[model samples]
Target: MGGYGSGRLHDGRVLCMGGPWVSAIAKDDRFVAGWVTHATRWGIVRGRGNSGGMGGLRMSYRRLYVPGATYFFTVVTYDRRPLFSDPVNVQLLREAFRRVKQHHPFTVEAIVVLPDHIHTLWTLPEGDADFSTRWRLIKTYVSRRCAKTYQPPGSASRQQKSERTVWQRRFWEHLIRNQRDFDNHVAYIHNNPVKHGLATTPEAWPHSSIHRSP
Candidate 1:
C-alpha cells in the first residue's frame, strides 16, 4: 500500500521510498517502534507503528507496492561460485525462468547470466505487483534441481529452513523509474559479461538475452 515519497523525520534522518522499498532512521526518544514483520515467501515487509511516533515514522519501513511496475534485479550465487559456468546449469536456470513465467506471467525485458550471478529486468502485469513470489519460485526451482550437482554446503540457518546452498538469501532490486532508466539498466545487463571478462562483447555472450534484442 505504501508508495514513493521523501520526508524528514523528527530526528533529522531522511525517510525515502524510491520504488518498492522504504527505509528510514528515527530517534528512539521521538519514536516508539513496533515489531517488524517479514513475509518471507513474498519478501514483503510490514512495520507496525506505535501511536506516539511522528506521522513520517509510521510507515517508513514498509515497502511500496505499485502494480504494473518494472524492476531490475541482481541475483548472486552463494560464495560467488561460478555455478553457471556449466552449460547444464545455465539450461536449468532457463527452465526455472520459463516455468515460473508460465504461472506468474511477468515479462522479462532483458537478462544476462554470468558465471556467478544474473542481472535481469522484468515488467509485471497490470493489477499485480508480486515479483517477490515469482523470484522465490524461480530460485527454488533451480536450487532444488541443481543443489546436489553443485554440492555447496548451506549454513545452519539455511539448513534449518530447508534451503539450498546454491544462491544468496537475498537479491538486489530496484524499480525502474522511467524509459531512460529502463534503457540504461538493459545496457548494464548486456555489458555485465564483458565487464566481468567473460566475453569480448555483449553479443558474444552465449547466455545473454541481447541475442533476442533488435
Candidate 2:
C-alpha cells in the first residue's frame, strides 16, 4: 500500500517530478514516476517501491532527459559490498570513467567514492543527454576489469538481459535545478565520507574529488 506526496530526495538516490527537484523520506511510498520536460512540465506516472528497490520492478521512473543539463547520481555495489575499498578497485573505477569519457564526453562536476557506493554530478555534452548510456559503459568497463565471482546472484530478469550483478541494475539521478542546487549537492558529495564516519572531514577522504582541490 502506498501513495504520492511531497517526497524529498537526498544522496542522489531519488528523482523528483513536477518541480525543480525533490527530497524523499527513506521508506517506500508511491512516487510520481514519470518524465519531465526541460520546460518544467511533468508527465506523472505513479509507482511503488523505495528508491533503491529491486531491479526491473522499479523501472517506472521515466528519466527526465535534458541534454547538457547537470545531473546528480548515486550508484551502489550489489549487496552493499565494499568493492571500492581496495586501491585496485578504485583505480579500475577511475579508468572505467576515463574510458567512457573518451567516447561519450561528460563533465565530472563533483564526485565522491565510498566503499560500497558513489555519488557524482555530471554535465552531459550539448545535444547528448544519454547519461544512461554512459553509466552502462562505465559499469560494464569496471565489471569486466574487476570481475567478482562471489557476488550476489542477479535477479532472473537481470540474467535474461545479461546485466551485471556487480552493480545494482538501477541508479538514482536528479537533474540539477540551479547553481544553488549544484553547490549544495557538491557539498553533500564531499561531506558524504564524514557523514558515514569514514573520515573526519571531506578532505580526509582520499577516494573523492575533494582531493583535487588545491
| lDDT scores of the candidates, listed in order | 0.66, 0.66
Q: Write the per-residue lDDT of candidate 1 for residues 1-214, one digit (tens) a residue.
A: 1123343332324434344335454445323222112232355432222221111132222333446666677888988899999998899888988888788877776788889988887766656778778889989899998887765654667667887888887666665544445557878999988888888999899988777733
User: Model 1 off-target regions past 4 Å?
Assistant: 1-63, 154-157
Identify the candidate with maximal TM-score.
2
Give per-residue lDDT, candidate 1, residue 143. Answer: 91
lDDT of 2 by residue, 1-214 (tens): 0111121222223333222334433322223222232223533312223353212234445465666567788899988889998888889888888888888887776788899999988877656668888999999988876654525654667656766688887788776654456668878999999999999989999988776632
TM-score, model 2 to reference:
0.71
The predictions' CA RMSDs to the true structure, in order, are: 11.4, 10.0
Steric collisions counted per model: 0, 6
Candidate 1 residue pairs in clash (backbone atoms < 3 Å): none
Per-model TM-score on C-alpha atoms: 0.69, 0.71
Residue 148 CA displacement from its true place in model 1, Å: 1.7
